[model samples]
Target: MWIPPPVRAPIGGAPASDRRRVCARIDRLVSGGQRQGWPWPLPPSGPLGVGRSRVRPGALSVGMRRRRPGEPLEPGNAHQTVPPLPRRAPRPSFYWSDFNNVAREVREFCEENGLVDERRLPSATELRFMPHPRPWLANGIRRHGGWKRVAERLGVRTATDVLSQPADASAPKLRRRGGPQKPRHYWREWKNLRSELTKFVCENSDSARYMPTVDELEAHNRYDLRYAIGLHGGFRLVARQLGLVARSSLIMRWTDLTAVAAEVRRVAERARLPPDVMPNERQLRQYGPRGLVDGIKQHGGLSVMAPRLGLRSQRHYPLRRKPRLFWTRDEADRQLKAFIQQCGRVPRVSDFLDAKRNDLLTALYRLGGLRSALERVCAEMDIAAVQRQDGVKT
Candidate 1:
């Protein structure tokens, strides 16, 4: 006994013979049995026969003519029996009807079984009979302006719906947290203290006295008052409000030293110095505050005072020397000898001067004059060779 070949299922899951019979019925229904005047080429079979004919690849048999490239399909030549081409999904339609009603059904279903949980939405198994079910529902809602709009039309409150509600503009904004509120009496005290401080700064601020130092303020018990003003804004602003010029630093005014220097110039003129010579630090020191010495040094030193008095002078500050090389005389000699041995000859004076070991060459010159140093090194090389030979013989 032989095994028969397994019958291949027809395209629509029917037997081949059954498919022929079905196609015959469909063809008769589609073309009304008399296809002589039909625009499309019919199957090459008898009027009522059930034989199926295959169209050649890329050659559609239509309108009794071969469809050529670039030729548009004639209206009457559309393939009535050919399978439809696979098309991509169309753009979502915004005018979907009954969106509210469909959404209502879904919302009711979710609420009925508490299936509204976003992390675990109701599965499609429960909605098997519904057309397109949850996926189509979501797409339709999205197409018709989002889930929030759908929820509003269905009279349901979803997370999306709640979030979509506009915030009330009339609501008061919350204040940012900060330090504790200052007491009412503390504010009153602040006003009075600031006024007094202003008056004090105006009276004391002058070219002669300038702003009081922190130490001086501490003596008068106004240091804490200054700190309080700083916490509110800063001392600079308070001083500015009082029409007092703020100094860069608390210790001294920029012009204070210049004024003192001016006084020293007057004293110098009285000292009978020649008109062309400005007084130096040693001469200017005897005329004013001892602190003036350091101030003079900072403001480009005593020479800076010369130009101001229309006198010519020059500043002379000490210059630093370069450090000495690390190598000793014996080490330098060994290095020089090794260099001469590698080079196959002693270096010329100019070559030695140009080398990194030029300092060593300078030392060699001092030890035994330039020409004499080369003679000594050549003599040492000969003696070392003789000693090596004697050691080998021993």
Candidate 2:
């Protein structure tokens, strides 16, 4: 037997010209497709049966036109045929006749089930699970309106329909949960918070006079009361409400010296300090009752009061110093010159403030004001004089 070379379809059937035309049409459908670009020229959109023809490397040899069952094979490719592209099904649209049929079925089903389960109507999900499921009924219901509106139009009773029967305008709307509104938190109200604060202070503090700090509140895990404090005003206002005096207010007020002495001793006892150790005024203020430090001050100050409470005087207050004599003119000029040299320009009042030199500021004011003094200094140095920025005093 002779082994012949593989034979291809005739060139005239699916000719190169027809292939390029078909490929161009396909490229319009899918942009930048393999056949649409590279090596191949942008093809002319010629009708079937005419154009200059050329073969592509991997082109298929199917005839240009589809042949029906009885038609003879095309000329160029005798054996191969190109099936026509599939046509899409037309889009389904809402029609009254179809919708009425779907509605009639739904109504009949609802009527049959009504006696068994009152107000029974099939949901889309329920329709899908039925023995002879009708998908069109659900789709029709969706197209007409939502389930509720459709049910309402079809005389089906929803929960809202059963409940809103009374037409009284003044009738109170029912809450989702029955009964009066549930009691809000006590901290939500100032009066409630004050009472709660009284209880909290009495129970948690060393005595009735200690007000809890923010840190103490956080440590106790009662950060919720942070809201309470803001609603009722700050710690001092709250302490005043409770008949407790702030140490600052207590120091300024005159109270019985005997009571003050007694208060100091009481604070030392309950100070949260080491046992048998007495506290100074600072320590008593930190850990004792609100008025304790001031009480010590009222009874001849901390130095005198500490001995009575068996505490060593901490000598905590800053010692007073005499104000220095005003700076001489020469000294003032020397200082201003040095400052200008460092800055390379006349410095502003803000520069003095930023450097924390209020004493130098006082000396400048005393030396006949900033500009007058700086002008004298700048003149002596043979430099250009500077004026105060925007000159008029605020």
- Give the TM-score of each candidate: 0.22, 0.22
TM-score of 2: 0.22
Once fitted onto the true fold, the runs of candidate 2 whose alpha carbons sit more than 4 angstroms away are 1-182, 245-394
In candidate 2, where is summed lDDT lowest over 10 consecutive residues?
A: 173-182
Clash count, one per candidate: 0, 4
Poorly placed runs, candidate 1 (over 4 Å): 1-195, 202-261, 270-272, 294-298, 314-394
For model 1, what is the alpha-carbon lDDT of residue 317?
45
Per-residue lDDT of candidate 2, residues 29-103 (tens digit): 334533554212222224222344433211223212222432323344445443334333343565533656556
Question: lDDT (CA) for every model shown?
Answer: 0.49, 0.55
Colliding residue pairs in candidate 1? none
**Global Cα RMSD, each model:** 33.1, 24.3
